[model samples]
Target chain A: MSVYTPLNEEQIIEILSNYSIGKSGVVDGIKEGITNSNYFLKTSVSEYVLTIFEDDNVNLDFCLNYMEHLARKSIPCPQPIQTNSNDSYILYDKKKLAIFSKLKGQTVSNAKITNEMCSQVGKVLAQMHMYSEDFKKNFSGVRNRDWFLNTYNKVQGELNKENASLLDEEIKRYLNYDCKELPTGIIHSDLFRDNVMFQKNTLTGVLDFYYACNGYFIYDLAITVNDWCTNSTFKIDHDKQKSLIGAYEQVRRLKNIEKKEWNTMLRFASLRFWLSRLNDQLFPTDGDLTTVLDPDHFKNILKDRKNYSDKLE
Target chain B: MSVYTPLNEEQIIEILSNYSIGKSGVVDGIKEGITNSNYFLKTSVSEYVLTIFEDDNVNLDFCLNYMEHLARKSIPCPQPIQTNSNDSYILYDKKKLAIFSKLKGQTVSNAKITNEMCSQVGKVLAQMHMYSEDFKKNFSGVRNRDWFLNTYNKVQGELNKENASLLDEEIKRYLNYDCKELPTGIIHSDLFRDNVMFQKNTLTGVLDFYYACNGYFIYDLAITVNDWCTNSTFKIDHDKQKSLIGAYEQVRRLKNIEKKEWNTMLRFASLRFWLSRLNDQLFPTDGDLTTVLDPDHFKNILKDRKNYSDKLE
Candidate 1:
């Protein structure tokens, strides 16, 4: 999450010309993401966020448009600001250019993740699912089941035998996930604690909708739980999971099929991310911004998800 | 005036809706101003300064438009951002709202005023004087000659006779200043160290256009020299004054008339701020934001200006 594309004042002003928003007075790099260069834009009127996509793969049409749709429906997320010409994005130096209304609050550090916070996140996540029910756009994440197995194969030779076999074993077990039989809707494919912003333990906004896609509702819940409900030792905190899922159910309850598929969804969530992180480590991008996230943390969670049958109750 | 008007998040958002700058993620009140409410806004792309004029008398047309004009000529001044409707300023809750591009440096503290800095301030001030040559719009400050004398009479009863007499004597001396003879132009009337920003001993930006007005070129130079050249003892640092004036004349040479009137202008420069600050002290506004500035610092400088006839060479 470092600045890969640094912009000057004139460049920033040119970008602001596409909209009626005020101009920036000062700008500093926000060091947190791997895909894009982000700057905090402050004007005399209000504050905003500028996202300059460094990668060609940024799905502005789906992700930003989805955020626009969700924000209009009263979901607590960053709304993509349309350009004065009414486009969700503009091309800047052949890269995706867009700004979003900055959300209130901040992401809680992992150590500070509490059950109450989880409950709030779960509530928001549930509301998001229900709110976007009418949004017909479908998206499949780049790091899905196929990516999991493919990434494992790519990084298999680089890993120790134990870790390699552990990866293969998990991939095989959940390889036959029957998505057609389960309830499905749009899912924020990446709902890690860092993607959520909170004010005084109350979740104020969900951020970084880059990985959002159409998927099993249980999949989103699983991905969220694997991050927020996990303890320091990589085991699920029963109280936190209960708090999260309990609050989620208050907004949109899980179906019977979803309940039966809970543990598998949890396993797949960990397996996919574990493989992805391992792949990134093995084939790291050539940049200073490539923050090598830990792979083994999710590996541990992958194994723990298969410990006993997860009871939704 | 301090933050006489404290705005909450919703009020800030409502104000931002008028223009298209991205919304702020975090806004913190800037603590170093006297006539308006200012905030440093940080969003995702850039930074900006928000000024809400607390006084009903703020001249947005002359001050903002003047800054807009000066900024175009590449003078180190903040340019005002216009609304989508192309208005110079928007009325927020009936108070003037305008955003400016944040300048690059910070105001050099009085203790850190360097000769190099005074030279830079001099060059920029001279450039500003020359650059706005075509800008025909004029602004007369309410804290002008008439206000100074009227305010003196208003505060006469509050003073302990000694301070009052010193003010009256200075006023009577400058009361007959022949404005027709002096070369008049737009002057940044308050070029105090706090109003000029510097980075690494170089002046980067001149701020607070609220006090900018049509006035004598020597008057602006006198104000600049008195503040920049003054020492801790409130006596003029001759070397600093020389550096400032030397750099200034390199851009716009002083006429014989301006050179002859320099000391009188210095005393008047000190006299105006002295009277204004005294009036503020005697009749402090009814708010926690009315930071009491000492009137005697300028008074001491006024006495010192009368000690020696200032020379342009």
Candidate 2:
């Protein structure tokens, strides 16, 4: 159970019927996620997914617009199903609801994620990131640090003095460090394995865009490699990473500063998740029944970042 | 500025004077962290750290008691400064706070964390883990999968559908995998460089008990290695890892299951932090004016963990 109210089958069906294309009769609730209420929908005409906005309305809007733009640029993504009146979305009962064409394929879950898959994901990200104008025109939100501090403060009481101090120091270091500016665009902030769909060896679609925001494009690549390239452990799969980076660079062509910032960014990315999970574990909200992740898992990653940073020097 | 209200200088001085046997003079706030407020105090006779609890009052009490027990067992730690009424802690303005004798030492912060230092930290962890009767009697927090799930849910919004599904699958897999039951005792949840103070080559004091909970002994060894040992590129320094593990095993032999779980735990640990930090970067707080770490660093660590897990297999 998430910390938000869930939508039932009737509610979902009613919303889908208002879309440009009426429902195709496939409506099944997805019970896997801890954040939103997702339903797999298929109409007599086409397949789609009906997602009810459960959190962060502004972010959802950003993602929806970004996806619509990506679809226009020939990036393979789920297109938004408009209302019967041709409206892209409908505000129903305080929930901003939208329907998307159901992406056809299976998610790569095991340790067998291939180099080819990594390359494709990377390439897609590069292409999506190339849309600098669309992102600049469409979405504007807080930077990564601001988001972290806001969430961290909400659950600050759950942390200890030492952990809190370390967090504070890390925040300060990030503030003081000169962050390299890169091509800014819409970034798929969460590009883990499940967010991607594959049909056999063919890449199908990039799924979740709730965290999609205007930021450094490289950050998306970082998120993808972080999710798909690695296994359950914290080791770097050289072949996969190489393939992914190669594919991304083939499109974006890494600048000197981007490459220089790569290792640090990697460390920062790893630490970012670790700290966020730590905050969640410390402070929980109502209706949130999801299990808290272990803070210890990222300990090695932090250590690795320290080492990685040293090597860069 | 954390969400938790911090004590003023005068309040800290009052607490110090009311708690310790010595005369309190100047109380200078050291740092306010995500979990605790720290103040460096100087009395006419000695110096001490005034720590205010920000979260988990019960766990904090357990940690304090456990630390006192460890001190009695000849472990090097800051001695708790008792209050005027002989209480180790006092409730001031609805917050739990304590004072402790401040040890004189410098915290290691450079990238040159030596193998010897790693070995020493590992050894100390082993020693701490070896305590059975008294330690277990004093602390009883169980380490389980629920901890990880809580964290996973916190950032579920940022995760894509495929990644979210993968997380669910991983959770189920973890539930089926039986964790090795070891001697349950107080373990230092966070044992990174900043927490361990040193004078010359000698370990002076180990700080940060906020994350100290009852968990497996091997997990402590893993945490220590995860924090203390790393390569220049921030990959787990394999050589340092070996040294740390060897030092730990020299004191506390690894059981077959413990050894088996080692690699997986390493991966899990890396992922844990990666996910956490990513959450922080995505949603920040106000008082957390610190830097939001990049989510990419842990992605690299996860990649590293994949490689390491393969090697272990």
Candidate 3:
């Protein structure tokens, strides 16, 4: 993650003039965000994060307004700061720039995660799902079924023969389970450890809603569990998984269908990340501060989920 | 180049507190320098550049003072801005930070070069070499004989069989040359196109002197010509080379010994960039705006210089 299109003082000042932020202060390039340039900015009034979206293909209108809607309903997420003109985003040099109130705490490293932290995350995820149910924004996620097929094709050759065969078999198996019966709503489709903020012992904030879209709620939990409950060996920490899911069910009980499809959801989630990580490793774009994760991490996770599925109960 | 270290507004304000250059303004990450994070900064007083040197290995004292000295003597170089305490640099998180007056004009791309532009660059280079003569800082370059050998070893396997053989032959031939007789002075060893800036028809500013050190004058000319006089095909444009060297000689004439070793210097200069490009390509670090140039560009240049040596006179 890195700042792609750099903003100079004059440029930033020009952007801030639309808002009553009382002049642009320090604009630091943050080492966060995958497809966007981020800055930790400060004004006289409040701390903010200035995001410049690099990829133009994503749904900005839904993503921007969705966060505001969720925030209004008491979801602990970054609320978008509207301009004086009430514009959601400003266009500078064809790149979309927007500011949001800074989240409360730092992102937790995966290794340092505890069961309490996982439980907090679980509650937030459930709350966000319920809060965003009525937001009424229709965005099929960027990483949907088509994404899996296309991404699999791109990264197919990068893996070893055994891994590649496993990936091929997994993709075929995941695509066959046409989960048209599962409950679909607004899901934070990509909630990794880095996308969460922990203050002291509690999850104070949920960050990075770029991938939030209309998807299966259980699939969203699968994405979260894959990142949060997993340890360094690419295997599940059963205690953390239990804590997260238990806390989650306390908010809203899972449907029997969601529970039946939970293991498949986990397998598909691992495959999605594996395919993405492989794509990044094999064919990465140039960036000043891009972090390409090892594909093997997710590959092992996919294998684990496929061979020995975890129980949600 | 990309910003490696991120500075929050509070952190930036703390750093700016040691200076009387007004409150911290927009600190935009700049895409410059291989081993440093740079920012385009502005305040009420003037627009400036903030550089955070990443590598602890480089000689900062000589490089900083050298620029100020050259700027004082009519060279188009960035002059360092001193802190309120009259210190040349300030330390933050063990990294040396300094401000410089932003250079006028933008860096010209390679395909847009003209004879007049090349001549202007040559005149500026010659003048800089002369003006920097009495600065009296003794520092050997980072990319010296040892670097050549070490870098070659690292990138040897990355090349094809033919290219590897050619590189081995060139390095062996280059190391045998005894250039002790050549007039040695301060040289901008990595005088690539991006390092020189132009506004309209004239060379307005010279930037990025991290590689500035005591070296051969003609060798420096070789570095400049290899960048300015070369086309995208990695072959020299003879008219541009003639125009450049012709102007440089009018300012400070080249020695007979310098002329004799000119072709070897060109090949060695090509080798330096080749090794660096290969290193960057094979083992690139994470950056937000990093541009890893194709190693083949310099490989072609090395091949061209070795096969057909150009005349400097």
Candidate 4:
């Protein structure tokens, strides 16, 4: 977690002038989220997270309205705080800015994810998917299969023979597969452990919806499982995986196709992250702070998923 | 602002079990302080700052007792939170950990420091000095004259001819001069603008006392003035300086010696920072995150202080 933009108190005060919230108090930079610069803006009245979107192409309406829509359905998400003019977003320094009411609960790491917590996360994921069915706005998944193939092609030369072949095979498999034929809906495409918050056995908040897009529901589940159920050694914690899937089924049962293609979805999820991380390493972003995650971790996960395919069933 | 230690929720829960601060809810890593691993711990009962002292020889008792002593005198400082065993500090993972009641208000940037704020800061600083007179512990200033000379010698080779001459001259001047004659007390050796917090019209918190040590109170004032009264180009803001000194006099008037040696003290402050920054650059620390502050900023300040010595009078 790192703050990119160093916004002073005056700038923060000026930004808050558009909103009806009282004078800002302690504006502490939250170095937690990776995608954007977040400040925990504690004003005299209430606490809110003021996020300045780093990527210019981040769909403001889709992210903000989706959160607002979820709040309307009594879901636990960071409801976007509105301005005096009823606008959900503000233009600060020509960048899109939005304030979200501070969500309760702490983000649990993968090591601390209990069976009950996994179940709670799964239930919340199912609920999020179910409630957002009527969300009219559509945003394309930036990290789709095409992105996977493209990123893989750029980084394949850097890999050794075995790793290169694994990536090549995965890319070819996804390129030929018709993902459009599966169940299509809004998906929280990147529901990593850090994106969700937990208090005891209950899930209190789901966050970082910038990656939310119109995608296959099973693919979203695969993404969640890949993150939440994986150990440090890249092996799946079978209990956690079972709890997550079992609870998800209680809310919205998996179709026959999803059940049959579960192993493929897992491999697809692993490959997407592997390629993304590899791309990041091969072509690093220019910034004040750049944390290129270890691509080898995902490589190990993909290899394990492929070699232990029957066991995954 | 960055967090070095990555403590999980389980470790946090175990740490909280030692204290009487109810149940810990959301523990967010505070990436503000440089010397310590601080967490903005929010529990069901209240919010507190849990600081794990990174350095082994941090003079835990001296710091904790001094803060506790100031708090007892109703000074606006964070009171150290005590444990069930009546100990202020906890030995966790071989690191000394202590919690303090979270202070109110936000730190003012240099641009946001108004005249009224300066006066308030001065008064509070004098109050701190006045209240801390009875504190028995004496931690030597780690950034003393000896540190400056030693650090300068190591980094002098890296500097150009002009910068080297400047360093040599300053080192010679400070070495020949007698600083032991000044009024010695517990000084907040590094009270930059960011260390002091303010609300609408009053100073609410004085934080980061890790640099507190036995040194000239006037030197501390000089350090504060040098930082708080300097503009973007390192020139002194006369009105702000006057305001700070004027309010400080109301509480604890400066001695004639201090008034006469004010310019020298200002140079001393500038030289100390310049040497430290230069040394850090030349001899880098081995760590995951080491923020080497620009030495050129302090170099400019020192040069300006030396050249404009007549005007400073």
lDDT of 3 by residue, A31-55 (tens): 7678888888875444678888888
Task: List the candidates ranked by lDDT, beginning with the highest.
Answer: 3, 4, 1, 2
Chain A only: TM-score per candidate: 0.95, 0.86, 0.95, 0.94
Where model 3 places Cα greater than 4 Å from the true spot, the runs are: A3-6, B1-313
Point out where model 4 deviates above 4 Å: A1-313, B288-290, B310-313
Predictions in order: lDDT:
0.76, 0.64, 0.79, 0.78
Instruction: Grade the docking of candidate 2.
Output: incorrect
Tell me the tens digit of each residue's lDDT in model 4 across A38-140. Answer: 8888764446788888887677788887876655433567877667566788998988898877876788764477889888888778767765555677878
Q: By TM-score, who's the top model here? A: 1
Off by over 4 Å in 1: A1-313, B1-6, B288-290
Tell me how each candidate scores on DockQ against the true complex. 0.02, 0.01, 0.01, 0.01
Model 1 residue A216 CA deviation (Å) reads 34
* Docking quality level of the chain pair in candidate 4: incorrect
* Cα distance off (Å), candidate 2, residue B218: 73
